[model samples]
Each structure stands twice: as C-alpha cells, then as structure tokens.
Target: MGEVEHVVGMDIGGTKMLAVVFDDQFKPVGRFRKKSKAKVPPEQHINNIIQGALDDAGVQKIRGVGMGSPGPLDPDTGVIIDTPNLGWKDFPLAGIVQDHFGVPAVVDNDVNMGTYGEWCFGEVQDCRNVLGMFPGTGVGGGIIIDGKLYHGASGSAGEVGHMTLEVDGPFCGCGKNGCLEGLASRIAIAKEVVALAARGDAPYILENCGTDLSKIRSGMLSRAIAAGDTQVERVVRHAAFYVGVGVANLINVLSPEAVVLGGGLVEAMEDLYLDEVTRAVNDHAMPFLRKNVRIVPAKLGDDAVAMGAARLIHDKLAS
Candidate 1:
C-alpha cells in the first residue's frame, strides 16, 4: 500500500567502521567498510561511510539510521559519555546522525548490538538468555536476559572483558592488573606471539608479520597457526583458556541458556577457540549451572552489529 523504504546500519569500532543498507525485508543491498583512525572525527567518518553505502545501494533516501559504537554511552539520550578508543567524550552520536541525515537514529554499544544481532538473526535459537564474548583489538561482551539486551543502571552492565582473571597478570588498557582483555584480546595475544617470533618459536609469524603488531591481525594469526606454527596455536589456546575462565564465571552467576562467541578472533579461529573455551567452562562451572548451556560460534560475523543496529532502530521507531 505504501512505497518500500530502506535504512542504514553502522558499526563504529576502534579498528573499523562498517555500514550496511537494508531494504524492507532486512536484506542487505549495499555495504561499505573503512579502517578507523583516531585522527578522523566521528562526524566526518560517519558521513563518508554512510554515503558510501547509500551510493553502493543506488538508493537516494533512507527511513532512519542505527549505529553501534564503543560505549559508556546513553541509549535514551544518545550521548556517548566516553569512548577511549575513538577519543570521543560526551559526544552526542545519535543526535549528530539524526540531524545530519534528517531522520531518527538509534545507538548502542557495539558488543551489545553484535550479540543482539546474533539473537535476532544468527545461530541462537529459542534462547532467552545468552552471553556473548568477542575478543578483538580488545575484548568485549554482552548479555541477554529473557530475550532482551540487559543494560544495567549505567548502560555498562555487560562489560565482561574487565573481569579480573589474575591479580598479578599483564596490565590492561583499562589501567588494571590482569583484566581479561589484557590476557585474551588480540593485542595481548600478539604481544606474546611477537616474543615467540623473536625467539624463532613462531617462524611463520616472524617471516610473515615480523613482530609487527599492526600486521598481526586475527586472520594472519590463524593462517600462521595453519602453517605449522604450533607455538602460535599454543598462544591462542592460552587466550581462549582465559576467555573460558571469564565465561565460566558468567555461567555460574547468570546460568545463561547459551554462550555466543563472535568478533575477529572467533571468526578466524572458531574451532580452536571453541575447543579450549568449552573445556575451561566444563572444568570450572558448576554441573547444575552449566547444564544444557550451548556454547556456539556467532553466525553473523562482521554484519552482526550493523544488522542489530538496523533492527533495533526499526523496532524502536515502530513502537
């Protein structure tokens, strides 16, 4: 009865920004991705990125916009209290986009959106409670309770990456000792993998990436492990073990129905992470609490946050 409308969804992170255009049926028609830079202002970057997607889709107008960004932000007011990674503080992200595009916009934490995307369109089935862990440039997490994203009083409820695993472990970016992010993030894994490369324990990484943390991305590490780098495998397994420890703690506390693993690290080395994390959860969690809890890889990959953002805004505006 009415003309079909399209919408844009975006995921802005420390490393990259991705925008996807979705049609009435929520199918992607166009997408664009760009490496993130601290020098670039969010307003400039989002404008270019969203325009890129619109251009690719050959669409002139969109109904609304949705975005996911690194948090300490307010969903109700659309104010970003702070994003250490992006060097943005007290930024009004949703409002900026709304004004720029002349349409309503919704924003949420990137991890929460990613996990919510999984719940809406990924492998999670018939599950009301879920725990999502993503190990990337840094580790992040999200929680689902009774089929809804749980945003505690401060909208930082699902910050599982800050959970301390060891009192005297490596220093985390969060200025803490032995937070899980310091032990399990891609940055942390690269730190140890570099040392191994120097010692010739990981010849593949040494020759391929040359201890260059910037070049040692998740896909590269996975390739190195596949190239007979047993030491690299060991390092990744160690990180997975720590992640498992965190997951174990959550399992004990929340008794979630499913635990979803996503992000660049999990996307590249799904089998390895699954094997180690599953082992750790089994070893540490209570038998009763861990029962019937499915641990699975996220099916959405890079599009999770974007899709979730799109869906969230669509629902929000409809209601």
Candidate 2:
C-alpha cells in the first residue's frame, strides 16, 4: 500500500450501486454504475462493477477499496447489521469485497461517507465540526466532531431522521411513527404528491407522474412546481419545514460548526429547502446556538459518498 497509485470507492444504495476510481491525489479517474438488485448474484455484480471502473481508469490494480452502504452497521467489522431498504441483515460486506478484490477494504455508513466527502473536499472543509442531513428516498444524517466522523456507541449515532417529531404523525420505513423521515423524506413527499395527483389537485403530477409514488422523483417534483403545481410545491415545502425542525434540534444538541444539506430533494428544490429550513431553524433553534452555523446545499452532489470513500481508504492505508 505504500506509494499507492489508485483506490476504488464503492457506494451501494437501495436502488443503485456505483464504483468510482480515484488516483493518489483523489481526483476521480473513472466510474461505473449498475442497478442494485438483490435477485442478481452480488459477487458477480461487485466484480463487474469494480472491473468496469478499473477498465475505465486504465488501471490494472488498486491499493485498497472503500465502501459506503446503508446502515445500521458495524463499521469496525465492516458488517451491515441491518438495512431495511436493502433487506440485508448481518451481512459481511467488507469481508466479501476484500476477499473478492484481493485488497484491503473498509466499509461505513453511506450518509457518513457523504458528509465526510464534503467535509474533506467540498465547501465545508474548513469547519471543525459539521452536521449533514440528506432527504431522499429516506432521510439520512451524519456527524463530524472535531474533524473526524463521529460514531456513537453503536457506530450509528447520526440518525437524525429517527427523531420523533410527532407522537403519531405517520408511519416510517423504519417502522416508527412520527419520525422526521416519515414526514419529510422524498418518499414521504412523493406519497403526498401522489395523493394530490390522484385527487386532481396536482394537474402536472397527474399528467406526468400519474399517482405513482415510485415514478415521482425529485427533478420531476421540481418540474411540476415550475409548471404551476402549487399543491406539489406546498408538499415539498412542508417536508422541508420538518427537516428544518430536525436540524434545529440537532443544532441545539450538537452546535456543529456547519450544517450541510445534500441529496436529491435539496439538489432539486434548493431555494425552497434553503428558505424553509432557514426559517424553521431561526424560529426553532436557540438564537445563540443557531448563530453562525452556515446551512447550505452540498456541492459534490452524487459523487460525495464515492469520493469520501476514496479519501477514507487512502488515509486509512497510509496510516
């Protein structure tokens, strides 16, 4: 691993898997993408993805591999304890990658890697402590304390979406009621939008997305709003408001140097999310705690987790 030439960062999400190759300096050289389908053979899929990226980069080998996957997981052991969306339980993801690829591999939570990716390479790099919240298929959160990713007792500490905002608000994918994710995730927003479309309250969504939650995506939602779908816009804003509430609670508890927002929802409707989240943070957060905590959209977009993974394995092997 001395004088490393390159490393591969793999991001495994509920719906997609991406492999990115980066040179020693952390510049992305090449990447590959595939659908994450459990029915397919995972070993072959992983092999194909890594090989494809290596081919794209024209590299015969890599020093190490770093992976980011949905949690709750054991980062130390590289085991995914559970991922409700992916239907994996107690899976030894890191071992499989290390053994199959013939290189050292490290695994961590996907959102944690996204935050670390941004903290290391994006706009918030200067901050000593940072909070990352992403609202997508589901809400995900990450925390960095004193320039390091913070893992709580279970290595799953930064689950801000699980915070109960209401006692009986709505059902969440995590099987909880009134969680912020239940009210504010892209999935939640889509569900409401679908209902609105079904009722003819959202003509754009009705005509385009057609009451199908899965068919409704972040960009489409934005387009619907721009097409004069006021109800759809309202649903998105309401979701943003709840996200801000969760952010306010975290601000009071952690007082992170910065609050960075990422994921599809923020990327698409950034203005609405920024305005609503800012307003809610101002109203709900302690005035002193909220002061100077810059909240902004993530710059890295889709590559954050992959780049973060590359940086992590590079540093880890170097150490």
Candidate 3:
C-alpha cells in the first residue's frame, strides 16, 4: 500500500482495559490488557495501558489512538465527563494519550463506538439509520443516521437506557425510575434471579450456580435457559419484553432502518432472546415503524467496541 499505518485501539472498561494494535487493514498486530484501577490517577492509568500496547506491538511510531470509553464523554472535546465505574470526571483522556504518545487521539462512548464499528465494517452496513444497543452491566445506545454518528446538543445522545418506561418502576443506577435499564439490564436480571432463588422459585438457576445464588451470573442464566428451564426462560422473557418496548420507542422516534442489539446479555441469551425481543418490538411499536425497522444482533460481538474505536481513526483519515 501507500504507507504502513497502524492505530492503537483501547477499550477502557470498568474492570479491565484492553489495547490492541491494528495494521493498515485493521487486523490485530498485537494486544495487551490490564486490570482497571479506578483509584489510580486517570492520566497515569491511561498512559500505562497505552504503553502496554506499545510494548506488545514493539512499535515506536503509533499513527493514532482511539479509545472506547464508558460514558458520558465529551466526544467533541475528547474529555471524559464522568463514568461511575471508572471514578473519572472531566478527564482529558485524548490530550493525555496524545501528549504521551505524540499522536492524534480520539474518544467516544464504548457502545457508540461499537455501533460505529458495526455500521462501518459489520452487519449494519446496509442500514442507513441504525439504533445500536448494548445490554451489559448496563444498557447504553448509539444512534447513526445517514451514515453519520449523531451526538445530541450536549454531546450526550443515544441514552436508550435512561428512557423512562413505567414512570414509577424500579430505581435505576442513574437515579431514575422505570428506566429500560432498570427493568431489562443484566443487573436487573440478576436481581430478579436472586429474589426468585431466595423464595426457592428458581431451582434451575440455583442448581446452575450450585445453590450459591450470589454466584449466579448472566452466563449461568443463559445456560439454564438453554437447558430448558421455565424459570430462566420466564426471567429472560420478561427482560426481553421490556427491552423490546424500549426498542420500539426508539423505532417510533428515530425510524431507523435497523436496530442492532448486542453485548454480554444479548450474546449469551442467543437467538431465543433476540427473537422474543424482536417479537415484543413488533407487537408494541407502531405498525409502520415496526414493519420498516429490522431488529438484528451485532455481528462483531465483544470486538465491536474496540474495532469501532479504531474505525473512528480510520474514518478520520479517509475523510
């Protein structure tokens, strides 16, 4: 090609950080990871992660760095406004990485970046308007309209999780009630499972976790559902119903061509969960909106976020 180019893609998660070096064609050259230490100085922690990736790739000239970070980040300014899990506030992540590595840097919400990744190089390429959602420890979303990422006025858009659902339902981590996240996220599912096990109602989940309900994870719940546990199916179906409702609301508003769902919970639950979720969306959404929007799972899996971060840089270069 014209020149050998490389970009560092870093995913700063709540519990861990992963950094990968990708060649000109976006294939991984090497990768590194470290336990996320929130209490550590934000700048120091980010620098360490970057250095780890550099060491793994054994490179001296990094073209650029793109980070998929937890929200809420000021994407325009490359500042991390705050992330509860990372204990960071208004952190100048882009500047820090750029100053340390002598390369351009970009940052965006992890889920948003994941959406970008899918739109650019994954399953959503055929879609002009897309609602990308991730249901993991929490629910987050990113919207792409006309092939451009849409960040609302305050640089804080696509917060599907915060959408009010019941108006007076369970409390969400965002200090709201009846949020889709409150009703349908992994934490919410686990809480439901815990309560059921407490009442001796979820023997299958209990058995999957070896009677220690605390050990029951979203993965175990998936396994229980796969093994045909009614209790597990019930919990998942309830969560899927709420998720579908939330997605339906999105379709009504954005009128996206596709709604791509992914993340740990969606991946683990597999097709059944997605089918139930799509069914709910189809039933609840307006007829026109429901018919026009296609619901599908993200194809990139866990790599979507990191790849999207890398795509941010690539797109910038291409443009």
Clashes of each: 0, 0, 0
Question: lDDT tens string, model 2, 151-200?
Answer: 99988898988999999899987787999999998888998998899899
In order of appearance, the predictions have TM-scores of 0.94, 0.96, 0.94
Which prediction has the highest TM-score against the true structure? 2
lDDT of 3 by residue, 191-266 (tens): 8887777677877776666456457666888877777677767887888888888888888888999988888888
lDDT of each: 0.91, 0.91, 0.84
lDDT of 3: 0.84
Tens-digit lDDT track of model 1 for 63-129 = 8999999989998888899988788899998988888889899899999999999988888858999
Model 3, position 246: C-alpha lDDT score: 86
Where is model 2 poorest over a 10-residue stretch in terms of lDDT? 38-47
Better of 2 and 3 by TM-score: 2
- Weakest ten-residue segment in model 1 by summed lDDT: 36-45
